[model samples]
Target: MSDLYEKLKRFQQNTPVQKPSPPALVPSSSTSKPLPDQLLKIPGIVRGSQVMEKIQQRDDAKKKFLSTLGVNEVTNPAGKYGYREIKISNRELPITKEDIGGLEIQTISRDASLAVFNANDFLFFDTETTGLAGGTGTTPFLIGIGFFDEDGFRVCQYMMRDYDEEAAVLHDLVKQIGRFPALASYNGKCFDAPILQARFLLNRLRFPITDMPHLDLLFAARRFWKKMLPSCSLSTVESRILGRTREEDISGELIPYVYFDFLRGIRIERMRPVLFHNVEDVVSLAMLAAKICRMVRHPENECRHGWEWFGLGCCLAAAGMWERTFFCLEQAVLEPSLSLEEWIAINKFLSLSYKRLARMKEAVDVWQRMIERGEDVFAMIELAKFHEHTEKKYAEALALTERAILQMRNRQNDVMANGPATVMYEELLHRWNRLLEKRKNP
Candidate 1:
């Protein structure tokens, strides 16, 4: 048994064990045969080479298109995904500092902080977005800003080449916006400003314009031209107010699609019109803001039409500028171009302005004129209150109240049908009874 064990150990010690070989290294390039045309045509099967080729083609097309628009690539340390900028010289645009100068921001915006800024301190801003359904999802692909410089009105457009570059665009845009003390935009308060604020919030950056004095020209445009123009959109105001029409422009509805197409690397030339449209919008914003401010400053000479006077009056009235409201309304009533409805509205506002200014005689005159025209129950009630409270003329108050009550009775069926009209009738009746008692006692 010992001899057998020694022989087995000697056999084990003398045997040579074989080591497993390492797996063979494959070449960097595959040598496998290409897939057949039929297999490659399957929905999910695409060659890596073909995918890369398409990406290269798209990148080439985008680069070529951006070059034609005179756009420059922007890089910063905060973000690697750089944005693009297109600078438009003052000579390329028709506007100048003289055109937009001499604006009273307080009168136009009614914000005293805005009063500190001159035309040069304002940034005329506009944005072209991915979609009108605004949210964080609605990205501003292009932002156009115009400002006055020693050279004149120069425009700078900041655009994101792709969705990933939005952070870079916002980073640069906040820097530019920080230079301006005031911001003016057409319909920006409702649309552009909110979307930009959301983008800044999502990018974890502070919105520079949040505390800036913002003058949304949309409200002022509506106040000045809503009655005179068919639509107070920037384009409409541009043609009607600025006396400039875009010879070549893209419709706002098609802008998003054009941007999407550009991003998809098709119809790159369509982006040119979008840039043009944005430039025009920025230019018109400055022009319209200037026009509004000038008209507000000198309504007597600037207002050419009756509706203009009425609009100015309404604006002044809203700001509680009773003296200016009276002057504008007085001029509006003198003009023959006002429609019947407009005339009645102006008269009502004129009377209110007169009352606000403590010009009771002018208020009485306006009420009498409205009454003489068609027995305006509103004017009658207003005059009755004035006579009762201010003058203590109980007989005159009773007469005016009675006339209003009679008018309501004459249209009793219509009055009773409307809830507000019924309430107004009850109020007139109450005034009539109170006035009668006062008249009898006096």
Candidate 2:
């Protein structure tokens, strides 16, 4: 009897459940491709002729779920998932309408389209997925969106109530996001958007999220805070940079298990935190975007920290805004807390910017500062070249070059070991000889 029961249990687990015929408008398992193996592994996953019945049951459950959270399901302009929007009057987020208004239009590497980006046209996008490492097997269960409105900021959340509702969720996302000129997310360029594209292809639906300017804030966050923060994760940026700490939040790693539990008949309350987490991510994207845009547009007033100034300077420098870049670098070098490496980097850009502005005195000052701080051979070489070529002070250049050569020898093979340094040392010798010849002839 025990062996017979074991055989029956194995058979039941392995057997494919019969799917109920769905409504014409609704996607059925037969027409849609099979769910991935990961999704199929959830216990009590809807199957059999009862599939339609379960869907009906899910509708009631979804109603209760949304009611418990005080959010309503929007089905109008149908094919929407559990979509709803909320307006916040006094949200503690950092972005304002004016900040979004001033955001500069930048080119996207992927799309090669350049247009002035309006914050109104940008949909702040984020996704909560069943798996982070994306493949065809993974699913995007929740999509969170935020945007600026006349009143303030509006955030919309679309969630998949069950595995079969993924198509509805995706379709609704496309309908909403496709109309927007661009999508902004923390790391959507590499992760969220691509995974979503994969899910779209797997579902045999048209991938509508494309060709728009994508502002992936992860790159921006790294540029701004990678030096100070231990990690560049959104949560880290939220706490460390944005000054927002999440409480009562569900850990992202456990989110998949929460969805799996819901499939296995767990109470809807368990998934509330997951929904809240997604909402927070979307809101944070908006806040971070506003902060970055402000720093870029008005670094002198907005950027407070030395590292922040340095980061903004690098961005301005890249954009060829030499005057603003110089000002930011000037502020950055005044920051007494800068690390040696940070100090060096800021001074290098500062000097370069000064040179670009034809301010040789300021450029020489930066190089001199670098040398006073430490025995930077690169700074010494730059200053020597400046003296020899710009100021025509050959004797001063010869003295600096001789000091570099003496230090290079005292360091015992330091210059000889580096190919570039060796070449620099030989060049210094040539400069010293040239200066001596000039002195002899004069």
The collision pairs in model 2 are none
Model 2: per-residue Cα lDDT over 188-262, one tens digit each: 988888888988898788887767677888887777788878999999889987799888698888898888877
RMSD of model 1, in Å?
A: 7.5
Give the top-scoring candidate (lDDT).
1
Reference-based TM-score, model 2: 0.79
**Candidate 1 at 311: error in angstroms?**
2.7
For model 2, how many clashes? 0
Which segments of candidate 1 are over 4 A away from where they belong? 1-46, 78-103, 318-321, 389-393
Model 2 error, position 81 (Å): 3.7
Q: Model 2, stretches more than 4 Å misplaced?
A: 1-63, 71-80, 90-94, 102-115, 266-268, 413-419, 429-442
Alpha carbon lDDT at 82, candidate 1: 26
Q: TM-scores of the models, in the given order?
A: 0.84, 0.79
For model 1, residues 259-366, the per-residue Cα lDDT tens digits are 998888888889988988988888788778777777887777789988888888777777778778778888888888777777888899788778877888988999
